[model samples]
Target: MKLFKLNKTNLNEVEQIPFKLEKDIQSLVEVNVESVFNLKFIQSELSVDKYRIDTLCFDEENNSFVIIEYKKGKSYSVIDQGYTYLQLLLNNKSDFLLVLSQYFNKVLRMEDVDWSQSRIIFVSPSFNSYQKDSVNFKGLPFELWEIKRYSNDTVVLNEHRSNSKESIETLNPTSNSTISQVSKEVKVVDEDFHLSKTNQPLVDKWNELKEEISNLDDVEITPKNDYISLMLNGKTLCYLIFRKNSISLEMNRGNVKPDGSRSKNYFDLDDPKKISKEGSWEWKSGTKGTIYKIPINKTTDLEYLMFLIKQKYKNLSN
Candidate 1:
């Protein structure tokens, strides 16, 4: 992609700055990990058994660990490497937790982490056609990001999206038992999973909201391990979490005050907003997070949910 600087009279083309080395790419990502991907950087050059991971990060959104690898120029199988790192985390969960505990100066317990959400992210200046094609499966827990730097001291990170309905489990029969089992454990959430997790009526209601959100231009539906995220322009606007009793939503907008009083349908915290506050999953909400609990026991609650969704959409689109 080409970037240009616009002045009053003309547009000046910005030159692409090539990465001097893989370390350069890794350093750029490490410094801006939180801003770019909302991942907390744990440590670089993390070695697990025989394989050395380029960067180890924590995903506070799903309460899982993410393994990021940077490739400058190499041909490798994204599927094999992705599953292998997931297998490593699944087999040795304690070690990964220890790294997180040590980095943040706190004790992390095994129960606090969600092992199923473990993922491997591959970052490079570019990828081969085969490398891109290998991760076309919708359920795979791998992310491919293309990073580039410009002469104007700007950087761009674009995530490669896949809409294929294929499942990686199709290849499990011929693969090792660990890969097969891990593949089953670390798959992304889908509509089928949502239907099974909630009743048909609730699923239909959520789908209604999804349809409205999907109608927006440049919007994408990303199924995460715990919630269904609605993203626009590569930024998550909000996410929907299905519970046994009600459907919970966390919006990504800030400066939203407490909406009246707390009710069964809606609730917003009254705490003062602070940028230093931690553990918020939304990219733009900062520390002041807003959550709405829409009761699924009644179908009429869908209208209220839609109102909230539209309000959030309007706030974020600006």
Candidate 2:
């Protein structure tokens, strides 16, 4: 994508800056990984057996490990490298947990991580059509991102989304054993997977809430393993969990006062029938803010829920 600077009604084209070294891209991304990918940066240059990972990160939202590889050349096969890295992680889980525990200065057990959600991310300035098409299979735990720097000191990172409807399992027989093994362990989750867990009435309610939430400004719905996250500006504004009868809406406690109490500026604090001050899965996953839970049963709940969500949208967007 081309970027232009507006100088008093005149458009000046911004020059693109090429990365001098692969390490340059790694450094920039490592320092800003949280803002860029909403991932916590672990150790860089992590070595597991014979393979060396460029940057290791933890996805708190998914409770999984993310392996990032930086590339400056376009000749390497992304499919091969992506599967190799994933296989390495599956084979050497203890090594990754050791690094994660040491980096966070805490002891994180094996059960604390969701291994099925693990993924590999390859970042480069550009990718060939073959590299792009290699990851086109649905439910493949691999992502390709293009990173570009500009003369205006602005940087852009864009993810390559696949349009294919085929699953990687279709070609597992012809592929190597490593591909089959990794495919069995890592699963890419989507909305349909979550929607399949509930009945049709709850599904309809979820769709209604999803559409209303997406209609809000700059809101993006991201489906995770356990919940559907509503994101604004790369930060999670709330989470929607599908239940047996109703969909639960979880949001961060936004209007807390200095004295450890919350104000009623955003949500209706008196409505215990709809809102609850209970701890949510996000709180258990080490998120730094308080999470509030609200249930959506019918159309009547949406007006109040969106009213609360709109306040959060305004706050986060500002």
Candidates in order, TM-scores: namely: 0.78, 0.87
Candidate 2: where is the Cα deviation over 4 Å?
Answer: 174-176, 255-290, 298-304
Q: 12, model 1: CA deviation in Å?
A: 2.9
The candidate 1 region of ten consecutive residues with least summed lDDT is 271-280
lDDT of 2 by residue, 84-195 (tens): 8999999999999999899889999999899999998889999999999888988888889999999999999888998798986777785558888887778889888888
Per residue, candidate 1 scores C-alpha lDDT tens digits across 1-318 of 889999988999999999999999999899989988889999999998888999999988788888999998867788888888898888888888888899889998988988777888999999988888888876778899998999999988888877798776676676667668797677666756755776666777777776776667877776777777888765676776776555656664333324433222232333232211123233352333444333344354445555656665665576
lDDT of 2: 0.83
Q: List candidate 1 segments past 4 Å from native.
A: 175-178, 215-220, 231-236, 243-290, 295-307, 316-318
Best by TM-score: 2
